[model samples]
Target chain A: MLRYTEDHEWLRAEGEEVVVGITAHAAEQLGDVVFIELPEVGREVTKGEEIVVIESVKAASEITAPLAGTITAVNDAVEADPGSVNSDAAAAWFFRIKPTEPDLTGFMDEAAYQAMIG
Target chain B: MADTPGGLRRTPLHDLHLARGARMVPFAGWEMPVQYPMGVLGEHNHTRAKAGLFDVSHMGQIVLRPAVEWPSGHARPAAHEEVNDLKLRLETLVAADVLGIPQGRQRYGLFTTPEGGVLDDLMIADKGDHLLLVVNAANVEADLAHLRTLEGTDVVLLDARSLMALQGPEAEAVLERLVPGVAAMRFMDVAEFDWDGARLWVSRSGYTGEDGFEISIPDHRAVEFAEALLGDEAVALIGLGARDSLRLEAGMPLYGNDMDAGTTPGSAGLGWSIPKVRRTGGARAGGFPGAERILAELAEGAKATRRGLRPEGRAPIREGVPLYEAETGGEPIGTVRSGGFGPTVGGPIATATLPAHLPEGATVWAELRGKRIPATIVPLPFIKPSYKR
Candidate 1:
């Protein structure tokens, strides 16, 4: 199941881990992404903690963790070519995390996320 | 985000901007387009490569006329004595050599406080019978009030007039199609022409380093003129975002960001704007406000000076980032006033207020996001100005 957060991040459950990336709506708002700083693998993060920093030509923004988890993998491709996030935000996952509890209590479904953005 | 706080005012081209899908943002109490569909980076690169039409009507345009008018309705000769008197009266408020500027010429000037601090920066054009001043948008009210406080001068705020800037290498060619004889006018030359029954006061000058023109037309006819200018294949409607980045790449200092009422012209690295006539050794010296301190700073030097900074990394170091010596980590030596990505330059550049006498090529560090990024002090005007001299 795919879930979304109010911060515009999306998480998709992929077997043992959940893939995370910013929604297309967030990428469009950020314009052309120039650079991104992702947290290192094996780094532990709590829910709502900042894990990634994305910078556009004009400004910068932080991406927060939607659920407590350990970062298992990071997308180096997005780091090398940040525009990929703007090109296809859904497929350009920033990192994958092994969830501590697998409980997405605060995350929203697609319909709820769409309504929030609207 | 659609509705601006405080009910932001809109320019005459507001609807046109919306029709073109502009991302509007509140700027200096006005709802102005920060960028369009092209985005800031694209708009900036386009302006450097081709002509960019900018609606700068939010800027204040004021006309200064002599207190006494000619008795007859017929056009009077260039009243040299009256014009001189008007220039002399204006010299009391600004630090530039207004009287020295010839008719049909424009000069950059600054309104300085009594203590040598800059009140505002403006462009003054000698229009034979009257002097026209183009000032910053936010300082219109205060500038008018300051002018009104002076005696023997008739100040008329051209509130009904809208201003636009067509800037880039192809600007002259694009504008010449609409207004003939524009290419003949050299840099800083001001002329008036009639286009489609509407009069345009054009000056061959602009904020961008490119050779361009600033057109002042009636607000009602502004859209017509703008649409005509946009009809050209080389012209694209640029917004304030690109305008700012373009100026920054040109090493131009913004009024509020680079220098405010607290910063002197000399300290702001704009001493050249104050002509020699207003300096210590000239015939008409020490007459304008803050002449004593300004001249002293001019003769000796200021404690802090504005310098261009080239960051070694790609991170956009924005304004207010503190600066420190790269090798020795101690208290900050300076602060960034304006910093952003220079698309043309292909890196992040900034203008910083550094301690005086920091030679060009000196290495410094900008504290950005807890990381100290190395920066090099370089001569201003990161890019060469392509003005048609």
Candidate 2:
């Protein structure tokens, strides 16, 4: 099951770790991504803390952490070639974070996310 | 494209831009198109390869001439003596060879403050009987007020006209199809032509560093004229985003971004535009508003100067990014005036203000995300101008 944040981030829970990536709508809005800087693994972050910086041809954007946790791993492929995220935003997970409490009770579901975009 | 953001003004080509699927953004109190479906890089290269149509209606067009009128056409015309009088009077504010500008020629000029800093940069054209000034879009009101203080010249704002640019190697051929004799006009040449029962002011100049023409036509006929040009296979609609990168590659300085209230003509590498006649030893020297330091800086090079910087890595070093002499802990030496990915040069390019006359091969460090990026000073204009001489 996929969970969504109001800031256009998606989280997929796999056992104890949660994978985080930007939504397809966010990617489409970002235009062509030329460079991206991902937060380092082992860095502690709180909810709503900005950790990702994406520079597109048109403008620059920052993605924030949805749930407070420790960054366990980051996707190196997207950082190596930032354009790949635009091709498949859902598949280009930025990082994996182990939530402090493992609670996603506040996150929106798919139905609520769809309505929010509309 | 629907209702613009509150307080944001729309150009005459607003509907036409939306019809072509442009992405609109707020720019200097105006809702302008930043890019179209072709995208910024695509439109940039397209303009270089063929021709690109740009809606520059946001720029201010003002007419400066002696108060006495001698003709019916244009904002106003003057007798030859009045024209010369107007030019000399204009010299009181602008630091350029206003008296030397031949009829039908345009030259880059600047307005300087009493403290020797640049207030704005502009294009001054001597249209035989009157002088036409084209200035930056955001500086319209300020420039008008600056010009309003001048005596003996009627400063009229020709706000009802829509300005457009057709640029590239194929620009001359594309424009020649509709208006003959444009092919004969050399660079910086300005002329008046009658098209569709309206006066079309044509100048063989543009901001893109390509061989091009800037046309001023009536606002109501802007859409039809643009449609007529877009009918050609070579012409495509370009927006502000591409216009920016194009000028960056050309090494042209933007008014507010590159050279602002604190920049002097010499510091901005614009001393070449200040003719010898206006310099220290010339016949008419030290008359303009900021002549004291402008002439002083001309003789003795400015302490701070503008130069190009190329980062070693592919990541773009953006504007307002501070630069330091050392990698880790030192005060910033400069800030990026204009910067972006140069599609033509196939790398990231930036221009910044650095201390004058550095020793050979000095590197400035730009810190981004806790990492120091090394950028070496390179000569301006990542891409040399392709203007038709």
Docking class of 1: medium
TM-score of chain A, all candidates: 0.95, 0.97
Angstrom error of the Cα, residue A26, model 2: value is 1.9
True contacts kept of each: 0.38, 0.29
lDDT of 2: 0.88
Can you list each candidate's DockQ?
A: 0.57, 0.49
> Candidate 2 docking category?
acceptable
Worst 10 residues of 1 chain A by lDDT: A98-107
What does candidate 2's lDDT look like per residue over B1-389, in tens digits? 12464978788899999999999888877889999988787899999999999999888999987876436645454679889988998888899999999999999999989998888899999998889999987899999999999887789999689999999989999999988889999999999887778789999999898999999999888888899999999999999999999999999999988897788899898999898999999988868878998889989988888989888767788888999998889898898888878889877788999988764368999877668899999887788788877
lDDT of 2 by residue, A1-116 (tens): 89999999999998898999999888877776777889999999998899999887767789999989999999999988887878899999999999897988789999999999
True-vs-predicted CA distance for residue A59, candidate 2, Å: 3.4
Per-candidate TM equals 0.95, 0.92
lDDT (C-alpha) at residue B176 in model 2? 93
Cα RMSD (angstroms) for every candidate in the order listed:
2.5, 2.8
Chain B TM-score per candidate, please: 0.96, 0.95
